[model samples]
Target chain A: MWGHVMSDEKKPVRKKLKAASEASRFMANYYHELDAASQKGQPKIAWCTSVGPAEILRALGFLVYFPETHAAMLGATRMSTELIPEANALGYSPDICSYLTADIGAFLRGVTPLSRIYKGIEAIPKPDVLVFNTNQCRDVQDWFAWYGKKFDAPVLGIYTHRNVGKITEAHVASIAKQMQELIEPLEKVSGRSFDLDRLKRVVALSRACSELWRNVLETASAKPSPLTFFDGTTLMGPAVVGRGTREAVDVYKILLAELNDRIKDKEGAIEDERFRIYWDGMPVWGRLRAHSDLFSGLKASVLASTYCNSWIFSALDENDPFNSMARAYTELFIVRSDDEKETYIKKMLELFKVDGVIYHDAKTCPNNTNCRYGMPQRLEQQTGLPSLTINADLNDMRMISDEQTQTNVEAFIEQLEENQT
Target chain B: MKSKPCYAGVDVGASRTKVAILDTSKNLIGHAVKKSGTDFTATADACLILALKMAGKKKSDIKNTVSTGYGRKNVSFARDTKTEIGCHAKGCFLYFPFATTIIDIGGQDNKVIKLDRSGKRTGFKMNRKCAAGTGAFLEEMAMRLDVSLEEMNGLASQSKNMIKLGSFCTVFSATEVLENIRQGKNLPDIVKGVYYSMIKRVLEMDALTEKVVMTGGVVAHNAFMVKMTEEMIGRKILVPDYPQLTGAIGAALYAMQNKP
Candidate 1:
């Protein structure tokens, strides 16, 4: 009774960015420099959070290392699941941020994914100090504290107000004052005096890189976007790790020009871009390629995302580096209330001309996951666009249900098709 | 005799495989359901043959075929595949033809799909990383109770005092069932509690609209679930004539509608 079935449809091919190699080299160089400094102990190494005060560390002549970046590498290399249980064995709940668990687990196991990429790198650079800003989540503080205790390094952090709707002068002053206090501890750790001129120059470089990154993201607003959120996640390396440096600014410049050229030539990241979707919440670091392929196969382009756009620090002003840095970090989307978040998402949807939104209800990272608070329903009611919530984690592969995700995403695309017709 | 042109739909669920045949008039003329087993392609072919025999038709008579559910892509005879969510929404909408909240409790998963008055899907949600409130849960509970899956529905109907299960996880619920059994609770009451827990789990997945429809293999075998759901929601719940075949029927409808 068996009859012939149709052949499988053609799979969509992803277009590679020409500047990706340059970005990779730049990142590798940054890591190599940190490794060198850690080995020589000439310029002390300071571990900073991804969104922490890296500019100050750079100005103090300390090589800055971001553990979150290392955590992402662990996730992308698909080694997080194996190492995460090590942290759980240390009495850390599996429910906390997977990045934290995976990083600590790797440390406890004395392994690094970076060692495979860069030869002779035994582990992440040893830190003389660890700095963090609690604007993103309290997990960063706790995550840094563990390393601080292990390395016998001083752990310093700037605690910012949560659920912030408006940034008042008082809020900026409070954060700026706290950042100013870090100068003394940072100087002692690095054995270099604080220089305001150098800080201004570093902040200015960071501001230039942020603008270029913002411009690269905005290029997706064009018809048939030149880049996808998956691309943004990779290309934002410099903006996240090498920020406040001339090299970061140069990398973004090369990337922006390449994207602009793609737009000029009417090129798209995917073979077909029939639907534009806005992704909210954290990236499923391990499944980026799979998710990208799934959407590309459905003729959809995830044009914009809150995670990639988090790197845009437009409020950074060189003239008032400390206060502007304070204002910029405080105004982050993750640190904002639901009201502010909703307004920001609505604006992004319009800017990108999105047909739908997909909310990643990441299992481990509640701070980054927004769908639990009825945001998807509220956004749909306001925008009249359909939304789908996929439950997965950034680094925890155990939480993902691949079959369910495929079914839900396919059904969501069908719903969007019906709406369009 | 010249056979009339017909369309077919096959739904290869995790537990069962179903097939439905529809004539040009859109009437479900024939259907069949069987254990999916290991070979989805063979089971699907067997179901289609049985359904076609019932319809008094042959393979050559079917103009188009569509497949749905978990093993949808495994149907070698199907020309296209649709998701279970869309098929369920379409199947329920064909009967009610109005705004509806469709709760489908299948073997391995559950879906809460919302449709507008025009039969367009307004929203949808699926169970995340769990198998509670599904046929698999009921089967596990039945195994724990040392009863057949078919007997639980009838046992639930005969309950005098229904024992409420506190846990929604299937594994935990199974342990709870054992505890109640150990405490000398009646089998009927415990079975009723299992049904209650299943219904409550699906209801909590999403809100019901003015109209609520229940479908899927679990609902097909358990009529008492529909009655209990009505009593819980304080309203009448709609059920298609063959709730188990709605997804397959909906797929058949798509075949008929999109025929070349």
Candidate 2:
């Protein structure tokens, strides 16, 4: 009811990716395997941060589960707004990460959106061990600690340096030592010996998978991008949850091939690509479809984002798994200094040939929200590209006013139009 | 004699609907303002009819129409629609013709838009999902003070010492006003305090340029606010002759420029 009045005839149709089915299947299989492992209790369950050392857990015979992915699921299903208040009732501030609030609240209420999708899964897999890295944010440590306390699971943390401008050997060594310390605890929980060969194999698969995922994202640099940020968010499921596995590599290979074919045929993610925009923060999980449709209607392709490109771990090397994992995770855009972030984003804008930038000032995700620090104004001064900041939350729908966002986005497009002419 | 074709712009805002008609030479020939009631399309049509009558022209004389403001899309007769941001910028630039920051305090939103000397927009910011610094905040404060919205401006002007409100939230400010009234504070002082709060909120939204122009319905009615803002910033602020009609006039200018 609250949207633009563009006619159906005028709205450009979104071209669906052919490999989405394979990616979906791959994700389902990965979740089901974890669910089975949880039930059997044979393969130990390890809860890891999305960007944590998942390969180590997998190699040590632990079924790794990412609670952040489950939080994203809660957000996507629109259940987060209802469930977040449950955590709030328990003294969690509404200003903290909505994902933590919603996931913890869902756990407290004995409900999950996953039950409806994955048959026979009443709740998320319980963890035998919980691992986290502070590269993403300090909040993930708090989030994992809560679960570790409740489940009586051993909590392992790899505290990395923040605001890193350049990934130094000292930084890498510090994180690598912390990661190396996890092996003994991980082996004790899994009742298995640590295998360096197994870790090497898993790390190699992760490297290959990430390379293919990067290629899939880079395909957007082509004229009339073969994909949009909306597509990347959904397609990056394998790269997030299924990394360090052959299934993840296989899924990305299929995806990259299909995108290449789309590029060869001069096909675009939308019918008309009048403008290309760079998105510089977390996705509004609940409003993804609405936003995707909104941009498609405007004939604008949001071709790049700091969120989707966060998973490209090109520095990963199988020969030096511990140090490489440390280097790859430490070099994340979220952990970088503002200077490095600006350099990275400017390169992305030029690489994608973007016409404008949209900075989503997500209220709950201050770490991901870049506009609060005058990055938008600074970027505009340097690149001469217009930028608009929309205030919303990644998971909290209350923070979003559809009418206000619609007006701001339309005005930004108009600004781009004026600049072009 | 055949009538010359004129361009029309309708600004269907959250609180009011305005229509501005311009001749082929971009002269402001007619304009009308009316409260935008429940039905935005109906309010827009009525304003357009009144504006056309004021211009002594028929609806057939309008060759192009552009609509702006919050309800811009609801105007059925508009050939196209532009945002209130662009419209305000265009409208203000037409009068100032220089690098200026335009701060528009509308019914439900406030915008601080910057433009270069060449009329290109440098950047802009709007109030984020709040009604603290707009006309809505003033209206709420007026109701809480049990005074007419029009009387508050005069009351604020008559204040000997203004009380500054600590909270920026409209709801909190209303409670603060009641507490002041219970404390036997002077009515004029409280009213001026409310005005100061509004100005402080807007100023915090963005930094003003060397040349700042204030517009919109609030600026048109509340001249004391303009004086207070100038005193606070220690600079003379510019105002258009008809502040409320600038958005509509800008829309009309756009209609004229894009006329088929």
Which stretches in model 2 have alpha-carbon errors above 4 Å? A1-9
- TM-score of the A chain in candidate 1: the value is 0.99
Give per-residue CA lDDT, model 1, range A164-236, as digits (tens). Answer: 8888999899999999999998999888899999999999999999999999999999889999999999888
Q: Cα miss at B40, model 1 (Å)?
A: 0.9
What is the CA-based DockQ of model 2?
Answer: 0.43
TM-scores of chain A in all candidate models: 0.99, 0.97
Q: Best candidate, lDDT-wise?
A: 1
**How does each model score on TM-score?**
0.99, 0.97
Write candidate 2's Cα lDDT for A112-133 as tens digits. 9889788888879989999998
Clashes of each: 0, 0
**Cα lDDT listed for each candidate:** 0.92, 0.90
DockQ of each: 0.68, 0.43
Query: Which residue pairs collide, candidate 2?
Result: none
lDDT, candidate 2, B34-138, per-residue tens: 999989988988998899999988888988898999998888888888999999999999899999999999998999999999887877888989899899998
